[model samples]
Every structure is written in C-alpha cells, then in structure tokens.
Target chain A: MKALNRYARAVAELLVLFALYALGTWLAQALGWPIPGGVVGLALLLLVFALNGLKPAHLQLGAGLLMAEMLLFFIPALMSLLDYGALVRQQGLRILLVIAISTVVVMLVTAFTVDAVFRWRMRRDT
Target chain B: MTLEPMPLAWLGLTLLAYLGSRWLYRRTRIYVLSPLILVPALLLAIAAPLHTRYAEYSADTHWLMAVLGPVTVAFAVPIWQQRALLVRHWAALLLGMLAGSLASMLSSWWLARWLALDPAVALSLVPRSITTPFAMPLARDLGGVPEMTAVFVMFTGVFGAMLGGVLLRWLPLRSPLARGALFGVGAHGAGVSRAQEVGREEGTVAGLVMVLTGLLNLFAAPVLERFF
Candidate 1:
C-alpha cells in the first residue's frame, strides 16, 4: 500500500506538471503572449502552491524526486547533433571555435558584470 | 490532419540514457560533467557508426524539447517561495542581471563575428546560454538552425553546471548570492539546478535570475541581432 501510494503520487505530480504545461501553452498561444506555455503554466502552478499553502511533507518528496532526475529529460535532444553531423563537420571547426571562445567570453563577462553590479549596489547602500 | 502518439521511440531512448547517466553518477564522482551532456555525446558517437540519424530520432522526440517553457517556468516556484530574499536583494539582483545579460550577449556576438561563422550560426550562438526550448525557437526565427542551437545550448548547460562552481571559486568575487545569480543568467535551467545542489540560498537566487533573464533575452536577443 505504501509503494502503491508513492506510485500514485508520482503519477499525480507528472499529470499536474504536464497538464499545467499544456494549459500554459494553450493560454499563451490564444493570448499571443510572449511567454511560452510551459513557463506560464509553471508560474501559475507556483502561484497555486503559494496560495493553497503547501506542506513541506506534501511537496518535498514529489518535487525533489522529479528535480533530482531533471537532467535525464535533456539527453534525447542532444542526439540531434548526430543528424546534423555534416553541417557540424562543415561548420565543425567554426562551431567548436565559436562555442569554445564564446563560452569563456560569456562566463567571464557574466561573472565580472555581476560582480561589478553587486559592488556598485553595495557601495550605494552604504 | 492526423496526429500520432508521442514518439515511444524517443521516449525509450531517453529512458535508457537516463539509466546510463544514473549508473555513471553512482560509480563516478564527476558530478560536474553531467550525464545529460556526456550520455548524449556518447550515444551520438556510438550510434553515429550505426548511422542513426538525428532528425529521425529527434522527429518524435522534439515533443520533449517543446516542453522547455513549462519546465523552465516551474523553476519560478522556488523563486517565488524566496520572495523575501528577492526583495532584500532586489537592487543588487536587478543590476547584476542587467550587466550579466548584456555582457553575455556582447561576448557571444564578438566571438561569433571573430570566428566568421555563418550569420545564422552566429545568431544561434547568441542565445546558447538560454534554455534549449526557448533558445531553439528563438534561434530559428533569427535565422539560426535549431539542431545546432540545441547542441550549443546543451554544451552551455553542461559546462556551466560542471565548471561553474570550480571556476567561481577561482574568481575574485565572494558572494554566494552573486555567484548563484550569475550562474542562472549565464547557464539557464541546468545552471539553476546545479546551483540548487550547491545550496538553497544560491539556488533561489539562481532560479529567479534564470527566469528573469530568459524573459529579458526574448527582447534582448532581437535588439542584439540587429546590432550584429
């Protein structure tokens, strides 16, 4: 019974997640909002959680379990690189070059800029 | 028009990949180089020899990617839950995100142009730091290829999560709040997840920054494209 209940909860979490996802998509499309459906639904669900008053016990298990394995969902998509191998080969050097160079650039700039802004804010506060 | 069932083929593959990643994480301590990135890259190399095309595989699986928005938005829950922290850090957070977003955009553009990449390819890289679903579609509209954009987005996620903590340690900066915010803005969903693993306070800030900047990039991207 304990195992069965756990299964049901897992299923329920997925159902709510996907339904909210679909609804968010539907609402966004219908309203022509700039935000995506999944994002909208997630936001809506968060609101519901806040208003409904969640129990730490009620949510901790489900959200934790789902999030713990979140990275798993992304794997299938990366295989798309194989289909585009030729383009990647032709553009391979450039793609790698761009990704490599831009990654460092993005990382550094992001870190520096974020640090600078915080420093500026701290100074202002004081 | 006839609609088909969600592709079981892709779903199955994702499941297998997930299993492999879990096994790896258990055996190895390389939490930084996540299974999501490594497993797929491994699958690609091994399966490429088998000639399994990405398009055919992604055809049905693309539905999975399509859910990027909700998955991303769900992150807002933790962000909202930490509303007090946000209010406290509002000034610093906003200022940091603004600088982070612009710096990310400019650096990506500069690198793209310097490499003389195809304009579309260059455009796609601009949003690589954003989550895949949002970045992929936006890249397509701006003349970037979805498949390629997907690849870079994955790479950015993996790199950010894996090296982000280690790298941040070496930097001169010293605030967990700032570090988490930077990770979210620069790395998006994956980074936010990694930030959560590191600590709750950082996770909260990172998750909020990711959502806010993702929304910002929707606008920032087009303007940056024009500038390029």
Candidate 2:
C-alpha cells in the first residue's frame, strides 16, 4: 500500500511536468519562436521555481527519475546511426577529427580563460 | 512477429540492453563501458544482423524521445538549486560561457571550412557545442540539417565527457567554477553529468553554465549565421 501510494505520487508529479512542457510547446508554437519547446519549458520551470510558485519537492521525484534515466533518451539519436552509415563512411574520420580537436580546444580555452580571469580579478582586488 | 507488436518488443529490448550495459559500466567504471557508448554499440550490432531498420527502431522508441522535453525542463530544478552560486558569479560565468560558446562555434566553422566539408554540413557543425534541444532548432533556423547537428552535438558531448578530465589535468585550473564552466560549455549534457561525478559544486556550476550557454546560443545562432 505504501509503495502504491508512492507510485501514484510519482505519476501525478510526472503528469504535472508533462503538462508544463506541453504548455511550453504550445506557447512556442503559438509565438512561432525559434527556440525549442523543451527550452521554453525549462525557462517556465525556472520562473515558477524562482517565484516560489512550486517548491523543488513538488517536482523533485519526477525530475530525479528523469535525470537518472536521461541517457536512455539519447539512445535513439545514437541508433539513428544506421541511417547515416554512408555519410559516416564518407566523412566519418574528418567529422571525428573536427569534433575531437574542437572539444579539446573548447575545454582548454574555456577552463584556462575563466581561471585566468578569476585569478586576475583576485590579484587586482588584493 | 507482427508489425504492430514490434514496437513493444523493440522498447523492451532497448530497456534490457540499457540495464545490462549500465550494470557493466557500474561494475567496471570504465569510460568506454559507459552506457551511452556501449548501449548504442550493442543496439547497432543487434540491429544490423536482425535487419532492424533505424526508422522502425526510432518509431518504436519514440516514447522515450517524448520524455526528452520533460527531462530538459526538469533540469531547471538542479539549476534552481544552484541559484546562489549563479548570482554570485553571474558576470564571470556569463562572460566565460559567452567566450566559450563563441570559440566553439568559430573553431568548428574554421575547421569545417578548412576540411572543405559541404557548406550545409559546415553550417550544421557550427552549433555543435550547444545542447541538442537548442542546437537542433538553431541549426534548422540557420538552414543546416538538424539531424546532422544532433550527431555533432552528441559527438561533442561524448568527447568532452571522455577527454575533459585528462585535458583539465594538464590545464592550470584550480577553481571548480572554471572547470565546471569548461565542461558545460564544451560538453552540454554529458559533460555536465561527468562534472556531477566530480563534485557537487562542480556539478551545480556546470549545470548552471550548461543551461545559460544553451539559452545564449539560441540568440547567438542567427548572428553567427551571417559570418558562416
């Protein structure tokens, strides 16, 4: 009975989340906004939380469940590889090289730049 | 065997394979064994021999995709939890993310052009640094192939998550904020996940940066298209 109640609550929380996302999608479509509905939904959720319209606990269970299984959502994208076999074969190495080098460069640049800026600010203040 | 029943079967297979792969990743903690890498490989292996079409598999697994919106929105909870940190370092974080995001876009454009990729393909590569949800629409707006943008975004995330640690070690970064910003800017969702594993502060800052950078890129994409 306890487990059943918990499951029911989870379902209810998930429903609320889905409804908010749907509303966000509707708003974005109605406005013809270029931003994705999911992001608009994120903005809405952030506003609601900031204004204390909903406590974190209200969405915690559902959000936690989704975050824990987030990787599952991406599997389809990876699976779509089957459709891109030819493209991958033709330009796979080149694409990989660009992604690899850029990722490292971005990481190094961002990290070091931020670190440098923060240290420089501290030194100036001191 | 029936066509109508196949979606359910495929869904079950996805779940089982993910669970098995996740268990192996947990037991070994090997980066390559991570579920993100392994499950897809496992699916591709099964898919080829079984004659499973990507379209069919995707249609069957659309329910999982549907949850992505909510999952993206759900990220707000974590970001909200880090509101204090965001408020304190808003200037630094924002500047860092903006620089990082621009660097990612410019570098990708330069490399794609240098490599002489198709113009459309090069355009798709421009938004590779942003999270997929935002990157897809941005790519579409810029006349790039959204699907190809998704692939680049995923590859960027995986590479950032996999190599970010090794690269960070060689850098002179001692601050969690700087490290987190790097991961979030370079990696998107996967890098944020990796950041979370490192420390709470790192994860929180990374998540905040990821959200902010993604939102920033939405506005920046149009401006970027003019150059590329």
Candidate 3:
C-alpha cells in the first residue's frame, strides 16, 4: 500500500539510484573504463528515467528535501578538517590563497570557454 | 571499528544546527546566505574563540562526512536523466574539461606559490573547485585533510554563488554553453545550483560540467601532485 504513495515512490527512486550506481560501478570495473561507477550509474538511471517517464518534475519533493538539507551531509566530512588544523594554523594564508585563486581561475575559464563555443556555433550557423 | 552512539548524535545535532540556522536566516531576509553554508563556517570561525576544538567535534562527526560519497553517488539520477544533452556535447565537453582543469590547477598553484603559501596548503587549495564529496577524498589521498578540503570547497561554492554573476558579466565570453560549463566545472555544486537560478540552459551546462570536471579531477590530481 505504501508503495503506491509519493513517499514510497521517492524511496523506490533512491533504491533504483543505488542499484544503478552499483551496476554502473561494476560495469566500469569490468570494462576497465576510466570512469567512476557512480557516473555509469547516473547514466543508467538517466536512461531509465527517460524511457520510463520519470523526471525532475516528478521527484520534486525528494529532490527539494535533499537540496534543502544538503548541508547535513557535509558535517562528518567537515569534521575531517580537524586532522589538518595544525597545517591550517601554520600555513593558513597559503591555503586560503590556493582556494581563492583556484576558484577565480575556474570561474573565468568556464565563462571564456562557453563564450567561445557560443561565438563559434553562431558563426558556423551564419 | 565499533558503531558508537556519538555518530548518531553527531548527525542529529548537525541536522538540528542546520535547521536552526535555516529558520533564523530565512526570517532575517538573508535568503542569499543559507545555514548550510554559514553555520559550519561559523563553527570553524568561532572554534578557537569558543574553545570548542575541531578535534572534539570531528570525533563525533566523522561518520557523517563519510556519507558524502554515497550522497554524491546519488547524483547519478539527475545525470542519468540528462544523458541526451551529454552525448550531444561529448567532444566539446571533453576538450573544455581538459582546458578548464588545467587552467584551474596551474592558476591556483601559481597564485598560491606567488603568495608564498606552503606546499601542503597549496595541495589543499588545488581541488577547491570540485564538489566537496570528490574534492575531500582527493584532498585526503593527496595528503590534504578532508575537513580542510570541505571548508575550502564550500568557500568556493559560496563565493561562486555570491559573485559568479558579477564576474560573468565582466568577462568577454559570449557562449552560454561554455559559461554554464565553466560554472559547473569551476564552481562545482554551488556553481551549478547558482547556474540553475540563471536559466535552464545554464543549469544543464553546469550539471554537465560538474560531472566531467569531477571525472577529470579523479585522474588529474595524481599527475598534478608531482609538480608540487
């Protein structure tokens, strides 16, 4: 009976996600592809969703909830920084610089690449 | 290791803290800043001042961080659904990733060393643009602390979400695909989420970039480590 409800569907989707991830992971390992198993799992799930008519529109509740509480998932990992506290204390400035610069670089590069692609595509079309 | 009650308690407390921060931030019209981004930061900022050691807090929360891997794996659902767009841009994406990642690594490295940062910290900083889940493990494996990487990645996310648009305007790039891809690849989760706010196409590109960038970082970090 629960399986017929929205909550049930959400759970089922999550289960399917996990199963697909395992399958993808296994397949990649078997095939010796450089890609991660989760990537493969994602591809598989995307296929199923496409064929079966499941979409982001359908998973709104679960996805919204997941996004809303997304920070909850980072807590344990945040704790891991404790191991690096000494390093941070000793070289905090350097660490800060790296993070800041890398972020800027990524942002600029992405923007440029997209811009270039768009310009190229438009030129070709003309 | 034996499963302890603290692991559960840590999760419970983290949930409480996150919810509490969300409620307070929402009521204050600070919609742009969420508890998820701020609270952990507040904890870190005030850690020494509050006399609450990260070591103590981490002892209770390590298992919670471990969940990031599985949660990341969960992203497969959205990705799977978006496969059509991915195949369409396969070649462009591949080249863009190589270019984006190489630029990111070299720039971060050059900038940090120019600023006279230590090697370990520099290593930590290299992967800040990737999602925290992937960034943390790579950071840890590369001799950077996962927690430090988490904080760094979050900072990058918050910065991207907060200032990316302003930066986007100032830049000369006119292609939405490249811009969106850069947002996702460079900013990781927050960048992608922020891109979603701009429009559908941007979000799609951002999501694609996040996936490819993650894959690239998985292999690229080891090669980059040699230079450090």
Find the candidate with the highest DockQ and give its number: 2
Q: Write the per-residue lDDT of candidate 3 for residues A7-123, one digit (tens) a residue.
A: 787776556555665787789889987555665655665566668856655655554455445577775556555456676677776666566667777777666665666567668
C-alpha TM-score for every candidate? 0.84, 0.93, 0.79
The residue ranges of model 1 lying beyond 4 angstroms of the native Cα positions read: A46-66, A120-126, B1-10, B31-33, B193-200, B219-228
DockQ of all predictions against the true structure, Cα-based: 0.48, 0.71, 0.46
> What is candidate 1's lDDT per residue for B1-228, written digit by digit as tens?
111244465567666766877787768857643576667866676667767676667666666665455455456555566778778778677777777767666677777788777787777787788766567666765677766777788777776776687777788976777778767877777788778887887787787777777666765655655665
Q: Interface RMSD computed for candidate 2 is what?
A: 1.5
Give the range where candidate 3 chain A is weakest over 10 consecutive residues by summed lDDT. A60-69
- lDDT of model 3, residue B104: 76
What is the per-residue lDDT of model 2 for residues A7-34, given as tens digits with 9 covering 90 to 100? 9988998887888889999999999986
lDDT of 3 by residue, B1-228 (tens): 222433555446666777788888768746444765666665556454545556567666665564454455566555665768778766566667777777877787688778887676667777777877677766765776566667777777877776777777777665567768867877777788778877888888887678668767876666756665
- Candidate 2: segments with Cα more than 4 A from true spot: B1-7
Q: In model 3, which runs have C-alpha deviations exceeding 4 angstroms?
A: A1-4, A19-68, A80-90, B1-9, B24-32, B42-55, B225-228
Model 1 / residue A88 / CA error / Å: 2.4
Cα TM-score of candidate 1: 0.84
Better of 1 and 3 by TM-score: 1
Q: Rank the candidates by lDDT, best first.
A: 2, 1, 3
Q: How far is candidate 2 from the true structure (C-alpha RMSD, Å)?
A: 2.2
DockQ order of candidates, best first?
Answer: 2, 1, 3
Better of 2 and 3 by lDDT: 2
Of the candidates numbered 2 and 3, which has the greater DockQ value? 2
What ordering of candidates by TM-score runs from best to worst? 2, 1, 3
